[model samples]
Target: MTRGVGSMQDTFEKVIKHDELFHEEVLPRLKKLEEVQEEFRVEIGKITASQTSLELTVMKDGQQTRDLLGRFVDHYFGTDDKKLVLKEKVTLKQLSLRAKIALGFIGVLGGSGGILAGVAAVIEILKN
Candidate 1:
């Protein structure tokens, strides 16, 4: 009990003090950290789900968007799948590159006969 700094009793008391400090202070902070960590995990999960869906640019509601820009007004719980999905107020026309290129050519060309007449039919369909 009368020993100096090198005493075993002194080291033991220091250890107990540190332990009490951990229980009183560090434990509660650790608990709050766990809650924040869980929230981050949930947010990362949502981000991962969005990433997966974006790979195909398809929503659970059988609607597709552009692979790059994508489309949506907001997200909602789907009626069928009951999963989070984007609500689309607008649907972009999915056109083939060939059709788009052909349309460009047709736009450049004025009214004509023969082969142009066949293209005119396609243009009529594309216009809508």
Candidate 2:
């Protein structure tokens, strides 16, 4: 019974030492770490809010520019007499043939060699 009592006392002293070390050493560092984490979180929130505000401003400006350009086009170019007039009347059969030719041309241009050639042709045309 005395040996058991001595063991209990030893264990109690060890636990007291550990509790003192935890309170003196670990607790303050843990509190500091928590404070730093809170600061980082606040900074991230500020950066995200700034980015969202900038994106909203850019979207509003783009919408305003698009509305202004659309109004200008309606004022200047919205007339029946300003419409394009084809030289020949296109029949349904001719339209179908033209569509087929266009599809074939697009298919050819989809190939790598054809894409290079088409780019070269466009560059030449632009140069001219």
Each model's lDDT comes to: 0.65, 0.73
Worst 10 residues of 2 by lDDT: 84-93
lDDT (10s digit) by residue, model 1, range 11-43: 999999999999999999999999999999999
**Which candidate has the highest lDDT of all?**
2
**Predicted structure 2, TM vs. truth:** 0.51
Per-candidate TM vs. native?
A: 0.40, 0.51
User: Model 1, residue 67: what's the lDDT?
Assistant: 31
Judge candidate 2 against the unseen true structure and give its global Cα lDDT, from 0 to 1.
0.73
lDDT of 2 by residue, 19-43 (tens): 9999999999999999999999999
Taking the candidates one at a time, how many backbone clashes does each contain?
Answer: 0, 0
